[model samples]
Target: MCHHTQPVTGVPLNSCTSREKTSILQLLTLGMNSHTLPTCRVHHMEGRADPGRVPAAGGRPEEGDEADAEGDGPWPEAGDPRGEVGDFLSLDLGGTNFRVMLVKVGEGDAGQWSVKTKHQMYSIPEDAMTGTAEMLFDYISECISDFLDKHQMKHKKLPLGFTFSFPVRHEDIDKGILLNWTKGFKASGAEGNNIVGLLRDAIKRRGDFEMDVVAMVNDTVATMISCYYEDRQCEVGMIVGTGCNACYMEEMQNVELVEGDEGRMCVNTEWGAFGDSGELDEFLLEYDRMVDESSVNPGQQLYEKLIGGKYMGELVRLVLLKLVDENLLFHGEASEQLRTRGAFETRFVSQVESDSGDRKQIHNILSTLGLRPSVTDCDIVRRACESVSTRAAHMCSAGLAGVINRMRESRSEDVMRITVGVDGSVYKLHPSFKERFHTSVRRLTPNCEITFIESEEGSGRGAALVSAVACKKACMLGQ
Candidate 1:
């Protein structure tokens, strides 16, 4: 447990007292274990309760258990193809949309798989995210049914891979216990229910599909797996769109909680919940607090609120509102456009900041907001972008640093090539996001080699691979 508080001082735009800055930096150095800090208190929101405090190391198998290494059961030996070539269906449930794809794995190179048909992306309604599981799954089932009908897919019992993009506790490749909802989902039945079983039942009700659900995977984990299949050096998968999270391979021994197994492959760290310690740089400002306090999971993922696209625009709004209230900038505007949540998307700000043609970009941005830009407003917009982007980069680096530290501690290696597969609109499209992330990594790990691989293969393909592996493992065990 670590606790540190600093006085807010200086102009809202620049400079923190040296002493206060030092204290905050010290607080961050305590690492993720600083959860017990007295300042860390869970905030209350209607319809949102604590997700039953997760253990410090997450609830997965601990490091000490031999089972932590090679999984709870036996490791499948080499030379076995693991049913690499098979027809499998995959589903990718994302924050804003859901996709389902049918893929056929070809026997040849390890990770070279081809999609049999075009994938489908359906824009999910906002209500579905917060409604009952039946409602959500029914909608998904209809999509799947429509896909199958359009493609004339065989009615046989083909295996299915379910890639659920949320925080879930898994006992194996096939089972996932829902931890809590992220990506704007607050469905009642989905919170604690078995997602695979729910989807399976939903599909079964249609009577036209007889798919066997085999594996469940988080989006980041799937990205990692997919990347690893293509490039063995890939070790990390990160998502930075509506929300931010990273998954990286961890040695089984350092986990401390697993009971058995020794040669485990990797443990997905799910590092989004990191940096919730409130030890962030003073730029976190009161708007950040309101965002955190009002979120479904308050007092958690403070750093995410600073960086993730889901909150960046809102942060800008808060800061802009403050500026207006203080008559500092953007004064005498309608302010009505900023009243709604997510009124300003992160991309809008990024566009303004990336604009290099004199003040034309700034003028365009303000014009879109129905506000004529003054020189001060232009400066304010540029400053806001820089502050938000810098804070995001710094916090993102902290997460990478934690993972690198964990890896070094577990392996005791001098220098290792770490490949991080990143996905999401913000990461892919946001200018300077990559540069800032690289800067952060370099600052944190001077000796390590890091590679960033952008992957188009999302949870859909990754889940299919997991399903194939699971089925192959099951068949081998039966033999």
Candidate 2:
């Protein structure tokens, strides 16, 4: 939405007017306006649950119903990881790799549940990425069976925690109704189905996959739960990679569906699907528009397309293409390979930004497309990459700021020291990402103390912890 036109000065990196540069920075630093963010969108609908609503298992609400705090149903009891002691099976359906891990959590040195894992990795095949839901879940089931067979633990009905990351409305902790697919997933028969049922059926089809799914979790929620297991102070868990989303420990009283006696629970606020045709739509830059139009889902996940890792590299390419058109780089020569779709990726940005001595990696990446860049072009690429990624980091911090402030306002008494456990490649490996995230968070909410720590195995280990909780809750409910 930033209305900066082409520079009349010429195609030099520094030739752009101050207004043009500021527009890009504003898009990266704060988004269109603070109101166009998830913070305002969520605040307006915090407690708007419809009293006439009946909780349905794997239910889908009306169009605006997602805004209702409890319309998605009561937040399930997430079992305490602190006192959990046992060997639990965990399955992580990540974007790139599907993982099945046996996490051994038992009493350790400080009389706490220590986690150790017997891990197995299965590289999800290309066909499964865009294939049918059956193909995807069946493959995952096969991997589970393979892991059990390799470990010589078969025919055992072990507790399983399934971490399926997507938007889902869960009636209970162990089930989720798929809202829609993201992260370039276009598998048929995926949306509007229960992922737990799909995987369970897949497991049933595979006789060796005998474990019961005790809990179903989102990757981001698992990260928060994973961190909370280690440190009780961790109230938020997040994933900032191909896409960005956050989950936080919310007081149950505020959840309209829950009775006053129920304790606190974790809420998966699918904030990645944030932004719309209001101020946010009006604020879209030309590159952002291109990213969305070229994406699998157009006019959706506006925030994600602008800031998520999957689109960051594409953003760089879009900008580079613009420069090329303006005769800025490659002596105004446009490489046909650069115009090809999906040529540049987030990895290229990482390589360019992390370059210290020479931009060899950047050059090599571009070389694949048969283009040799000069020093000036390389510098321009690095700076643009940095700017795009910096914006992602800052936008992530802003969303977290909204979450922290919302929780703090409800409590209002203690100096709420919330800890956030973040996972994903962008936050974990990108240069200056950690510092940028921390700084932006501090800038937003200086009064409150927040610790943003990197967490791995959130989907794997966190699911195991949730399995422990689900089992305990099931037993208690029975009595």
Candidate 3:
């Protein structure tokens, strides 16, 4: 229910100005103010579609029920069905390193439980990374077999959770169709295939260990569940690494894809795919266009390309190239390394931005990249890196603000106090990114008090926890 009009700036319609150069940030802030983002619109319409429907889950109080006068459900109500006591296996396979974990959950006093975990990490070879699906999964199965042997649990059939950090169209808790590969992954026969089925087939081929794969979840969902163990208030999971995505608990009534309108379900907002519909064309500059055109998956995951670590370096490189062309850097002479694609790595962005008010650090990085930079050149490059990184942090915050506000409104809370579980190298390793991201999110969500908990080994633990929950639910249903 909003309208748009082209502004008359006393110049040609297509003419660019400083205001236009700064409008992307302004547009982000304004869109968040009006809750007009694509994410916000979808969340608001879906979450508030039914204001009076009673949740089928017994925890929520029904309207006009005298016993529920408090207006809030008991936090982690007695005998909560989510608690599961068992030993579970978790496999995390999103990045170049794959992990296998054995988690043991045991009952304790006063509804608390003790969790013990053992995990091993394996590096994925280049051949295995870009090979056929069978090859990729066979390597995974072999790793699991080796882990089970080390743990002396090769004969025990344990429930397993697969944490696949990619875009997936899930049909059930255990079945997901791989939409596409991201993070430089180009494994053949994976796209448009059931990810779990491929894993099961690979395990059968190995025949060294038996596993009951119960559920499959994205890394964000796993992080949320894992953090929920430490603080029950955690309902959102986000990753800002090679790619970006988030998942949060949503009222079941609002999820059209799922049948039951009861309690809540975690909805994975594959937000990296947000701008694929051309929603961000106005914000994209020539640098962004060039990066997109040369990417493995051109014109796809547009939002992620702008914010993810994989493309941030290339964006900076393009900007530096333009600066060279304008005679503003390196005396209008571009180094061969500067002209190379991906030569300016993403880590250089962090290193340059970490400079302590002196040009020494920036000069070192530029020189290492084959650039003979003067003091002015070093300063210019540092500013360019800061600009790119700042915009990325703000844009990510805008997306999260939309989610937090929607959650608060869905429950009719005057002030919602919530915790978000976060993971990934970009969010964790960048010196200023965490602070910048937190400040922006707080500014955007005025009605919410948010706490961000950085997760430790959360992906694997979360996958195991999700499997445990699914197993407990199945037991209750006698399935």
Candidate 4:
């Protein structure tokens, strides 16, 4: 029972009711398999073309071929060739951060390949998120021009890769229709518009220099590509931070959205939005429901609400709020700041968990929130933090396990090793997150050997690699 005891107080995890604990376990178990995922189906492209449009014979996606699925969308496989010499540029206009990167890919010791990159991050203003698409793109373009000037690459006509980490309906490698926006971005008139075209137009408006938009990809896909560049066994890519999503190599035949040769393509499993049908609804506690109800997009990203970093602190806050009402926390006098939504952040939880069992950090956190916590109160807070963080770790493992299990259905036992390329602050900085996640995966899939590789700047590096892929394919088609 010590394993279940609080690290500071050595008391069993009795803070929550037995029923609540059972529900949390069920949530973790349900995600350990994919059959329960609401969005697990042949991905639909909404108004996109038929999957059978690609001829069964050999040909790239021409003007009429269904473009969103696979044919010529820079579909990189395990051993795709990446040239060793190029100074490529990449722009990432996804999530809250807009970035521009320049890469010099060349040879290293003993003819081995090496890559060096420089990138700058720009924060988007609040107005841009709620304003028109043109406003957002214009700001992004200005940043790119500034980055180029800093690197003295003002005269280069470099082939560029665009990483737009949003739901897009691909028309080709360099073009795609923005299907929808997520992660608190609501760029008006951006939805249903082509992001690549928007970027191209934005760049042209600048009228500075020539830059070709060679490919467009999400961060998850780029992470996988980056990993595959370093290791041949990486097939899955994931981003687990403020929000969570995954992409993996899947058979073209199994994907209802694409049709063509007998090959595999990366499928962006937007697992963050997996609980649309309320599959995991029953397991949600009052605190979880409160966070959902108060969210910017309620009743969406259900899986993320339970597992993502942004919500972890809020969940802990809500539970503590409940305990306060019941005279069990903060000595029955909760601070007004603690009552406010979004006041607590994930860093606080991490700090509490990493404290040396002396409760100093938790004491400081509560003091900041206008609460004075007794020794017992600190222990209670620690327990709550551990419960929420542990559940999040288990959920992440379960999601990864589900992906592995689905892949195994069609793979041979000879395929013994699988590598996943993942990035995000939560995985890198959170105390004990990776250990718990690895443990959970091993416990659930005892027979499979899975490795997690950290691919930093996956979006930037991947965009460079994918641009190379697109350029090579274009050359092949011209032959």
Question: Which segments of candidate 2 are over 4 A away from where they belong?
Answer: 1-78, 81-84, 277-279, 475-479
TM-score of each: 0.80, 0.83, 0.80, 0.82
Question: What is the clash count of model 4?
Answer: 0
Residue by residue across 442-472, what tens digits does model 1's lDDT show?
Answer: 6666668888888776667777776677677
Q: Rank the candidates by lDDT, best first.
A: 3, 4, 2, 1
Residue-level lDDT for 356 in candidate 1: 72
What are the runs in model 4 whose C-alpha is more than 4 Å off?
1-81, 412-415, 476-479
lDDT of 3 by residue, 214-324 (tens): 888789877877887788788788999878878767665665544566566566777776667676776677888898898778888887887899888888888888767
Error of 4 at 135 (Å): 2.2
lDDT of 2 at 88: 87
User: Which residue runs does candidate 1 get wrong by more than 4 Å?
Assistant: 1-83, 108-117, 154-156, 275-283, 358-362
Task: For each of the candidates, give the backbone clash count.
Answer: 17, 4, 0, 0
Error of 4 at 303 (Å): 0.9
Model 4 Cα lDDT, one tens digit per residue, 1-479 = 01232334434335546664454334324233322222232121110112233222111122111122333222434225345368889998766678899987777887777888999999999788778899998888889899989988989999898877776777777877876677667888989988888888888998896798988887778888788767777887888777877777665665555456465667666667656566566557788889888876788777778778879999989878776776566546778899898888888889999988777788788889987666667767777787788777776777777667666654556444788899876788888888887787666655578888999789889888877767766777787
